[model samples]
Target: MESLEQKSSIARFLDNVFKLSENNTTVKTEILAGVTTFMTMAYILVVNANILGEAGMDKPAVFVATALSAFVGSLVMGLVANYPIACAPGMGLNAFFTYTVVIQMNHTWQFALCAVFIEGIIFILLTLTNVREAIIDCIPPLLKHAVTAGIGLFIAFIGMINTGLVKVGGAAVTLGSMRDPLVLLTVVGLIIAAILMSKNVKGAFLLAMIITSALGMVSGLITIPKGIISAVPSIEPVFMKAFSVSTSEIFSFDMVVVVFTFLFVNLFDTVGCLVGVASKGNLLNADGTLPRAKQALLADAIGTTAGAVLGVSTVSSYVESSAGISQGGRTGLTATTTGILFLASLFFAPIFTAIPAQATGPILILVGVLMASSVLQLNFSDPTDAIPAFLTFVMMPLSYSIANGIMFGMISYTILKLVTGQKEKVNKALIIISILFVCKFIFL
Candidate 1:
């Protein structure tokens, strides 16, 4: 009886903190959602470490940095913004960090880290000034809806690529072989998730992942981890390396270009994710802007900055949070749960890494299906709206870039509005943004 009272008291505390009732969610649902989100995006720890390792950094140190950055970012996001979004060193930006900044530019990895730090500071200032938030608000309602669907296609494509369900063919792309166990298991996982979803099962995404992982283990598809707990790696090698750059390197033109590229890509990636996920989660306000937009934007800004200090690439909101949101995560408690898990993963790396892409891929695909439904809310009668929205969603998968898709949509929207003599419909922020996009292509 005493234990039951303690449990009840804890439940009431959580309800008060997260406003569980107001969001139409419960403590159990939020926890499941957080776990689901973490499961889907956990691959980032290995991926980021490997990518940055190519730039001549310490692999073990980078791994520790990745986990710490994710923990810090997600914790701040949950406590400050009260949003369900999780943060990690983003995928594309890490590639650019190693390939473009470190390898091609002949800059030291430390220089690249410095650039990321600068870009993150700029992001914080931009967020404080509401520059980033205004850009989101200025986006046409149709385009906002398209962003949701676009990210849906983007992440689904990501899932397909991750699971070996899709491959590069002679031309653009092709399907994976049916004989491959990875591909076969992914298909079965998708079917299982679909059926669970159809039956309205709570925690369907999490359940699907567990079931698929179990199947893989039984079939000798995924290797079982040797053990669960490992010693936490020391981060001293990478920590604060971003501040080691020489003054000349910091002031160089290369730094400018690198910082600009990081800034540009991360800005849109974070914005698109926030807008898309918020839209899907019904967190957007009546005016199509997100409530607590400043706090939400600050979360990513802080993540990126802290990630740089921790010796990693820019950290931003992960679109995989949609998996949690789909599982009825409506408040910051979900993000807090994910944050705590990231912290715990530092010691349990092997166990977390043991979960393969085959298990998570289908969950991302299912999330794509949920987000893509926003397309139905769009008005297709006007060419001015329909054409841009079409490009926004279609180009995301084709170009393999959320930022590129948004760029095309914005530029075309501006052109169509001007050409159609509907200039009144375009706001000042939209025109400035369109011009900036053009400038990015020509200048960057």
Candidate 2:
């Protein structure tokens, strides 16, 4: 009788708070959805940690930070916004942070963290002032789609180079030796992943990575780590170093450009995913807006800030949450469940940190395939728009800089619009951004 009463009380609380039944969902359903979502996104831990590890950050520390950031973001979304969306350190942004900021720009990880932190705070202000909506509305759709597709190619190209599937020569990047065992294994993994994805396999990326890593291990390619389970690494390596070390750099033009890229990517990605998953769960209003849009945006902003504090890249809403919503998760309970699972992941940092980079390289490549699909949504009938979009797609991989792609795309876009008699489409916001892009080239 007592157990029955306890269950009744819990049910009443959830229904009252999240309106679970109104959404045609139950606690068990929400839990299942959460688990499904987590399984699909579990690759982020290894991928984020490994990517940031290349920036000279501690891998285990990054693993814990990634999990904790996801936990905080998802929990806040569940409780504060009553949404089923899950959040985590983003993919392309992390790659940009590590590869472009740290490697190409020669900035320390600390400086990169400072940029992310400032970007988060700016996002919070934007949400509060409702400036976010205005800014988003000002950007032309052609440029936005270009940015997404360009980043996709950028991500895939990075993975290819990292895995030695593509190599650089004096003249250009050339095909690597097909005889290399690791390269061959990555190709096999990519094919398997493509097949699984085509068949609608859940957690295709994570599963493919595991199978690939296991094969590498058997082939004497992947070396086993020193240990499987160990103490959770400390965040000291990342925590406050950025704030102190980046004072001078943070005010420079170069730092501003980096912060702007992080801001633009996180803002667009979160807004798009929030609306998408919300629509999937029927959590949006009649007018195509998330019911608690501001609250959800706040939760996302807080997640990124918290991530910076804990020492990781910018966190954003994961579109993979759509998988959860499709599983009948329609309330905050699902987000809570995902949050708990991410917190539990903190203990398995050692194992996650040990996943081979070659294994993760395949996941990045596959994700690029997913992201590049967004280009199909853009209209190519207008050359004025198509030319800029083309530039965005080509330059992202060729220049090896997301910031540069957007920068050049904007300049070309604005110039073409003016010369092609589409001057009305060029707004002041775009003009300002174009000027900044020009300054990035001339001054920074």
Candidate 3:
């Protein structure tokens, strides 16, 4: 009886802190959403480590850094911003850090880390000045809806590629072999998710993932980890290493380009995720702007800076957070749950890392379906709005870059509006961003 009271008291505290009642979500739902989000994106812990390891960084240390940075980023996003977004070392940015900065530019990993640190500092300044918030607000409503839908398709494409359900071919992409166990598992998982969703099952995404993993094991499609817990890896090698670079090295032309690339890509990518996820969760206000937008942007900036200090690439928001929002994660408690899981992953690395992509791929695809509903909100009657919105969403999956999608959408929107005598409709922020994007293509 005493233990039950303690449990009830803790639950009430969490409810009050997260404002669960106001958000129309229960503690159980938020926790399930968090677990769902973490499970889908857990691959980052290993993927980031492997990519950075190519640059001569210690893999074990990078793994620890990835987990810790995610923990810090997600925790702040939830506790401070009160949003259900998660952050980690981003995918494309990590590739650029390894291939462009470390290899092609002939700079050490430490130099790349310094560049990330500098870019992050700039992001913080932009957020404080309301620059980032203004950009998010100034996005045309049509394009904002398009971004939400586009990210949906983008993540679904990711799910297909990750699970080997599709592959790059002579033309663009081709179907994978039916004989492949992972592909077969993905098919089964999708079917299960479809059924669960149709039935309006609570925690459908989480349940589908668990059931899919179990099936994979039974079918020998996934190898279970031998042990669940391990000692936390040391992060000493990468910790504070960004400070080792000299000012001259950081001020070099190559480093300047690297920093700009990081800044540009992270800026829009984070914007896309924030807008896309918020739209899907109905977190945006009646005017289509997110409340506390500065706090959200600041969380991302802080994550990037802290990630660089801890020896990782640019840390930004992840679209995979949609998996949680779709599961009814309306508040920061979802993000806090994911953050705690990341912290726990340090000790249970083996178990968390063993979750197969095939298991989570189905959830992402289902999330894509949920988010694509935003397309219905678009004003398809207006050619100017329709064309830009079309390009905004189509380019995301085709180019495999959220930043590229936003760039195309913004540039086209500006030109069309100017030529069609709709200049009054386009705000100064959108115009400036479009011009900067054009300059980025020409110069950078």
**Pairs in steric clash, model 2:** none
Error of 2 at 176 (Å): 3.0
Q: How many clashing pairs in candidate 2?
A: 0
What is the C-alpha lDDT profile of model 1 across 333-412, one tens digit per residue? Answer: 99999998999999999889988999999999989999999999888899988999999999988988888889999999
Clashes of each: 0, 0, 0
lDDT of each: 0.93, 0.78, 0.94
Query: Model 2, 358: alpha-carbon shift in Å?
Result: 4.0
In candidate 3, list every pair of residues with a backbone clash.
none
Full-model lDDT, candidate 3: 0.94
Estimate the lDDT of model 1: 0.93
- For model 1, which pairs clash? none
Q: Residue 369 CA error for candidate 2 (Å)?
A: 3.1
Q: How much is 125 displaced in model 1, in angstroms?
A: 1.1
Model 3 lDDT tens row, 14-128: 8888889899999899999999999999999999999999999999999999998999999999998999998889999999999988998899999999999999999999999
RMSD of each: 1.0, 5.5, 1.0
